[model samples]
Target: MKKLSVFFALLFLAFVSLPAHAGEIPIGIYGTLTGTDTDVNGMSYGPKDYLTYVNERAGGVMGHKYVPILLDGKNSIPEEVKVFKRLVEVEKVVLVNGWSTGGTKALRDQINTLIKIPFQAQSLSSDVLDPQKYPFIFLLGPTYEDQVLIALNYAKQKGAKTFAFIHADIEYGRAPVRNALEQKIPEKLGLKVLADIEYAGGSPDLTPQLLRVKELNPDYVYIQDSAGNTVKILRDAAKVGVPAGKFFGNNYNFQHIIPGTLGKDAEGFKALQINADWGENIPMMKEIEEFGRKQKIEKKDAYYTKGWVQGKVIHELISRVLKKTGGKIPEIGQFRIMLKDEWVKLENFDTGGGTPALFYKDHQGHTQARIVEVKAGKFATISDWIKTR
Candidate 1:
């Protein structure tokens, strides 16, 4: 959407008609795609659907075909950084979107902050929302901390007293550990955390952690790791007889850490909170879903839904300002100002009808969340909705 930039500029300039631009405009989409495994990185097909839908019918935003340049970070940070720089400087792209939290963080840190280009993390994390840290980075979902806190409370209400924290001993693992522990008992709900143990991110065997957990026998288990190690933990958890308590897992990082290894064993495991499908009910979801179906594509994971939402929402904001700017972006600074203006107006806005939102202003502007669990080889919601975000 370079055309979107032109469109926003037009809006600022009080010109209604779209201005013509030469050649195809490049929009950066940085995420993992074309992998056998799904859900970790957004499906490339989903973007294809979104682009195709808008292009085929809407004629794309402001007459540009929405050419998304793929920079498959492949869940690698360095690669993500390299691609991000290439997208902004070499390619002269107006915006960037992609997969991988590590990649998002890498771009945020590596890029020149003063450049002030808007960035959104398709991954479901609030780390990027810190106004102090990555001011330009926008999150599209509730913080995992809020999600777990809601879960902790829910567990307490469901007679959960002791929680076992089984997480990969890494940054993602540590953040949740802090959130789960910092809270006091909420009124009548008796929630107590028993053990907070760390498992290797890719550990082949999780016997040590499982055995340690079994000795304590917690009332609930909250896992904060992904990849093959997560599967090993699930399998070994079953093998070691760690009491049939409520189990919470991370978003199946698509490494089959859960579905591949845990197989049916992960059924009913209440891990993270999210919506079921993007298209079955919601308008935005419908837009992407129908687009995918028409284009002969399928986007299984809600993460991709969130990513596409990021694109649409960001574009919507850009369109808002660009309408005023006479379809031309004066500089990166002005673009940042336009985003800040749009965000301030939507400070209280919530996408309540569908999908859990990325929110947090203090910690993050979290919108809402619903807890989902795996049932019979597919994910199912445990509660109708949990609005912790």
Candidate 2:
């Protein structure tokens, strides 16, 4: 009777030890879902929604369902770190999709040294581009430095002799501008730097800063900020006699909501287009649109396009790993290493017209972008895709 009782106890322990959903891949995703930076919440939802589409339509990859565990980082560095620990130590996610430049920078060393899970960052900050130091980190597009260079080149081509920068006072807003100035990128492009203006993000009024900009009256002003702040800058610039046509913004400022919100005030505003806009006649949009029909798309803009492309990349990499491991998911640690190894091997990979063919040899998936201007209150591609190497 004692031997039988011990055998039953062991069976119960084994049953409880099994995963709640066997063969489900847990990928951790955290972003500013409900916070000051909620304007870009689609960045978080894009991957989750794409993975859901895979689960519902195709039953996941290689019979292993992708279980995306999304959490709100609140765009705070401490919150992001807490979420990262939960995902890595408790949830045991194979990969993490992180948000914010500050959070990505804050967690870089920990991600490399201790956690060792693959990370996909939404930040395009050049500071985090060193693969030797942060081997597990990857970005969706060109570095912010690249975007600055592209914008400077565009300004020079349009015969602008002097430029200034108006950026929010944050890591995401200030780093790229500092890098550009330190590198003498504007000088190399034959444009003189007139002013480097920094302001608190989400400030209700930027007229004082715009008044300073009006005094300098730089030929062009490069805006480094989120959608909300960009709108504030534009409205104040117009009031301060700065033409909206003279302001250029990076990819983050390229959102339909901006033009839709400001209307004519947003006219003539230029931004970098790293991903094909939503509803474009591209191959990938067909899938996104089909998914939208079944469910309400949170944000119908380029950011969503970027998220969908990220999902596709994750799907392809996981599929490759599964095929190599004989259709079986390996142990968590080994699986993450394999994912990182497979990620770097991707080259000239098609993203269904989301961006130019992506090459991840340098850990930035794509480096090409085009200039889009707000014409008639809509973003229209103005130049051929410019390579930002």
Candidate 3:
């Protein structure tokens, strides 16, 4: 009897020590944690860290803990598809925050027909903006087309007529330029498209491309590539006498590393600014800073801010669902459908100055961005917030 009593006591202690939450809510976060585009890995780490903060600080959102599953897509489509299957089939995540324009485009059909979970993509591709067609997918900012138009409009305002495009030879780099041209946006902005050039990402030298750009002598050159490639483009532009001041970049290229890498060569480089930079005075940064004290912040830049904002959105939606369900998590299928319905209703959502107040009626939260130029080794806002709606 004494031995049995001791065994029962141990079992009771173990059971009582279990987490207070009824269950775990798995959320998938996948990005280029490795491979060529690792410069953007902050997009993946931001949400993971924020959700971790939520688990520790808030005790898992009304008795259900958030479990963020991180995966590396290696910036490859097949690899991303594999990661998607594992996140949906094996882990059974209710929501996903994904990365890369190419990967998002590849998974759109599957996300709509098979998985049916809410996907918050980092890609601002206009192709996925149609809520009627791609109801389950969402973006946090303006489309790539919008970014191009904003740059073109800025160029036109600066008294520039002809412009050229230099992009990486990838789906992400090619799509924005293609979309802009097909839509005739440059012509509408009173700007002519002179040359569209493609170069392999991380090329050793872009002197040839810059020479071609110089010969064309377009008043402005818009760059569509990652930060590393942007640095290369700037250095090679200087080498080939293509004035660096005449170049502009998309959001991905507006990175601190550019000026840090190229020094004076990166000065006067400009790109679209979507999320506020790290350490900016904002309400959200307080929470992130507090969390950082306890944990290491993997990426400390605008992309991380973008991810933190995404985490905020996820927390809001999940809280709403829990409230509606009376704190009881519905079955996975019902929970996913509820999430999708709740997302479209999100309006004027506060991001703590991460971006303009986000509205998800069109499945794209913020459609406004400002242009920032590299000055004295940092990106400084050069224009007021431009609305792309």
Candidate 4:
């Protein structure tokens, strides 16, 4: 009888000590954590590192600790849709973040049609801003069109009289390709676009295409490639002495290619990244660099940058959400609206400076990119601060 009584008391104590909301205040975060899939950018670490940043200081979102729900989209269109639906129906998480371009587009209609929960996407495509189309989706960066325009403007300043374009055949590559092919952008910028080319996935050698471009001698080359093949393309171009002096690419490659395998040949490569590598010579970089050192996150690894940016955005969103609804479980719809509405404060727009804004309504952030140059051996920044875009 005494033993039974003790067990009952222990059981009651356990019940009382349990967290009030063990399973509540659920927020879903999914990305390409581990897999052959690479198009998502370094988004694989964005949420995890951001959450680590949050938990390191403050307890959790709204004092209710969060449990990150990780899912591997496998960089597939259909698989992403399936996983997203499972995240909604099976898990019933309140909010979500981190779906790449293909995955984000896949969920566009389904999210609008059935699930009303607001989803935060790491991708910065223009398509997400259409409220009627993707009512529940919010993009994390500027539109693809704006990023391309920024690259275009840079090409003009570099005196690119004509352009040669190449891209890995994928939905992610389609935007920049179409933007280059369809638009009279070069004419407006007082330049000419000479050659536009497409190659099959995993083409192994871009030599034929690079050879053709060399023959054409376009002053600039515009390209987007799968993450795996980006290094090879740059290597091939360097060997052939392609006439692409001013090479421009969208965000897909900037975070993925540089500071690594692309090697010394990729030094002069210039890309318009939505986010700059505050990885060097910046206050945030300094702070995170110290933290990274402690965490053994190599400065060369782009995850540190992606994590830092994700932390910044998450910090802003949490602050805004708290101010609006302190302790209560916020209305999911209203919370989604707030998530989309809040913007992170950025130091310089783009790579260096002179741009005044960080974000605007048309699915774009004004952040400039570091004008990285390949000097001596590897990628070096000719101008740490590029003011144009």
Highest TM-score model number: 3
lDDT of each: 0.60, 0.89, 0.90, 0.60
Give the TM-score (vs. native) of candidate 3: 0.94
TM-score of 1: 0.78
In terms of lDDT, which candidate is stronger, 2 or 3? 3
- Cα lDDT tens digits, model 3, 1-389, are 99999999999998877644478899999999888988878888998888999999988888779999999999998999899989999999999999888899999998887879999998888877789999999999989889998999889999999999999888898998999999999988888899999998767888899999989999999998878888888998989887678999988887899999888888899999888888899999999999999999988988898899999999999999998988888899999999999999999999888889989999999889999998988888988999987
How big is the positional error of residue 191 in model 4, measured in Å on the Cα after superposition?
2.5
lDDT of 2 by residue, 1-389 (tens): 99999999999999877544448899999999877778877788889889989988888987778999999999888999999999999989999989989999999988888878889999999888888999999998888899999989888988999999999888998899999999999998889999999998868999999999999988899998878889899999888788889899999888988888889998899999888887889999998877887988888777888888888888888989988987788999899999999999988999899888988999999888899999999888899988887
Worst 10 residues of 1 by lDDT: 35-44
Model 3's alpha-carbon lDDT is: 0.90
Model 4, position 151, has a per-residue lDDT of 67
lDDT of 4 by residue, 115-172 (tens): 6666777666665667556656655455566666666777777767777667766666
Model 4 clash tally?
11
What TM-score does candidate 4 reach? 0.78
Give the per-residue lDDT digits (tens) of candidate 1, residues 1-389. Answer: 99999988988776444455413445677765543223455544444456556667877666555676766665556776777788888876656665555566566664327566666555555555677776666665556666667667767778766777777755557765664566543223566667779865656788888899888887778777554455677678788876323577654432323654576676666666454354347667666656665565444565556555555555566566666766565355566657655653545434434444433354344545666666676556676655652
Model 1 error, position 9 (Å): 30
Quality of model 4 by C-alpha lDDT = 0.60
